[model samples]
Target: MKQKENITLSVKNVSKLYGDGCAYCAETDAVLDKNVCPECRTVHACRDVSFDLHSGEILGIVGESGSGKSTLMKMLYFDQEASRGSYHISDYDTSQSNVFGLSSQAKRQIRNEILGMVYQNPVYGLEMDFSSMSNIAEKLIAAGSRNVGEMTGTGDHFLDKVNIPLNRKFDPPINFSGGMQQRVQIAKALSNYPPVLLLDEVTTGLDLSVQADVLELIKEIQREMGISMVVVSHDLAIIRMLCDRTMVMLNGEVIEAGITDQILEDPQHAYTQQLVYSIL
Candidate 1:
């Protein structure tokens, strides 16, 4: 795999606020506390989050629940609108653009052609009643692929790549086990070969054995495809296994970030140290 030196995705000064910015909300830096004003009642889902993802790199954002890691991922994938900031993908242009400024049409194009997302819950990513092949084909159709034969062939290829049985290609995901459903989700996300992939707690809720297998599959895909990925998870073990660099989030703010090994072995932040030790 050829990993480029260029920056792939750049996010700066991103925040997501859920309430009208009252005077208190405007002046107070409540993000570190992830607090809501007693009077204004604002929820800062993500606060001033900034990071650069390099080409062919897997960047992990790790945090406990309500730490805003998922919120940040949602902002990147356009599932939630950021209150402020610039988001730039080098493939789109060298100059940074305010992603929220783009029209709905433009965002849709970006989602279809430039980004792929695998949600934590299979239901969020897969159409349960649809066959495994159709689930993958839907993404291709959205990207303007029309030939049924080509779509089916492409679907089969990815299914095989993810180690899904070819015989089950026509079966609905509802009939599959938890691990198999996730494999189907992975196949669908990669069908278009997008430049960026967003995975949110991808292996959470799986059996330990299944989690290991899925992690190995993810590693294999990264090795083969060289796609840039933002993996959001609370599991430090998973982060250590998959990411080149890591960012530690706490209460809607990034408290620490560095190479994965450094962050895990020599954590400077109290929260990060606690996380690393808990796993040990």
Candidate 2:
């Protein structure tokens, strides 16, 4: 889609090469000979990738594993820096913010306040040992909210917003079902009220029935919070339900992107069409 000044996240010329191999040549080497191996090969996880994430819009990144969807989300969360190019959040140049270059304090500030990440692995991002309320409150405190009571209050409020009952607030995620844990994670992600929410396959392990509920909760929360989101998932149905725009990626590049309905209804790219068919 076209870039806009209202864009909350702008990634331009962003590329990531894991080792010494160049991005283009690495692909060339993989293609001509399937068995060919390059030493310390540069694995281009993301290729000169560019896209705009507008405010209050849920932009879904759909691709199979190894397709760079996760890597792109990592870059968005400032979990990793682009090997080349830059990402700008709001008016601040993320490139200049030096996702990798920032001081520990600066990076922490960005992470704790500006961006919130929900992972496919529930246990990975949240405090498994803590109660849902405790986990959420901790994040709010770290984000510079000195009012502990207020943070706790907001935490409970968000939990309810995400449909987590007050009775379960003190339960650790370990005892919760996959769906409930996901809800708690979503609550924690929003506790600090970050401007951006990055969800990496947040529905990976749920059954179809559970997935639907979680997806609905996400839509409701997104609508209420009015924060931008990047949802990474291979599930076309989920993406179709949640995103305003959807981007199709393959081997680290965005092959197609447009309004969710447009891409789902009339895909322009062959790969995109293939994905839509697969969904059918």
Candidate 3:
């Protein structure tokens, strides 16, 4: 596959620490547990993470529950602050800025215009009590769109795209099935037509059949929209299906990263080999 010349997003040396930066936390050589500082007890949720996402590429970050994949995604979407790092969106600025340094208002603008996120749980991304149309409208409203007619039309279009029938467009997500709710979340995320989409375990809690359908929907969206995506999931099957490139994370570090097929068929890292074998 040929890639475009420009990079969409670049992340360098990103780390998220839960405690104050004590001197002991800085000089620790504890290889066995990089996340825990034996001297100061600072928990490193993500440590020295770095990657580049090109336009129209789907990059997969795969790890277990505590491997910090979710933490990385949170940082990308501004849900959590990074202790140290630089994040740059090429379309927004040529110079990399610490995304954590941005003001709350600026961050909100970035979230509304530049980035779209779909969380593992629909509750985080959608209002259970709000109608599906209203849920999609919330994003447009946040982006300063006040035209009721336009918002409703856009919501209906996206809901249909996600296979949520027009009748359910007015129904609240609380009354919908898990799969339907997930689709609505996807629709809400794509409603803004953001340049980057961040998906965190979107199919984890769904049934196997439902998972397949959601996966297919995601692929279809990616194909039609050509949006760059960052997908974080514990399921290797999801990563294999959605990602062009894969990053294997363990203990808050990327142990291996490369083409998805290469990572699965010829895993070089011990942890990645274990993961691949376990799945097989």
Candidate order, lDDT descending:
3, 1, 2
Better of 1 and 2 by lDDT: 1
Backbone clashes in candidate 2 total 1
For residues 1-280, could you state the per-residue lDDT of candidate 1 as single tens digits?
2343488888988888888757766664533235465667788777788999998999999999989999988888888889988898876642467666888887877888889999999998999999999999999999889999999999999999999999999999999999999999999999999999999999999999999999999999999999999999999999999999999998788999999999988999999999999999
Give a tens-digit lDDT track for model 3, residues 1-280: 2443468888988988988856765653554355787767778888889999999999999999989999999998899888898998865653367666889888888899889999999999999999999999999999889999999999999999999999878899999999999999999999989999999999988999999999999999999999999999998978999999999998888889999999999999888998899888
**lDDT, model 1:** 0.89
Q: How well does candidate 3 match the true structure in TM-score terms?
A: 0.95
TM-score of 1: 0.95
Instruction: Compute each candidate's TM-score over C-alphas.
Output: 0.95, 0.89, 0.95
Candidate 2: list runs displaced more than 4 Å. 1-3, 22-40, 91-100
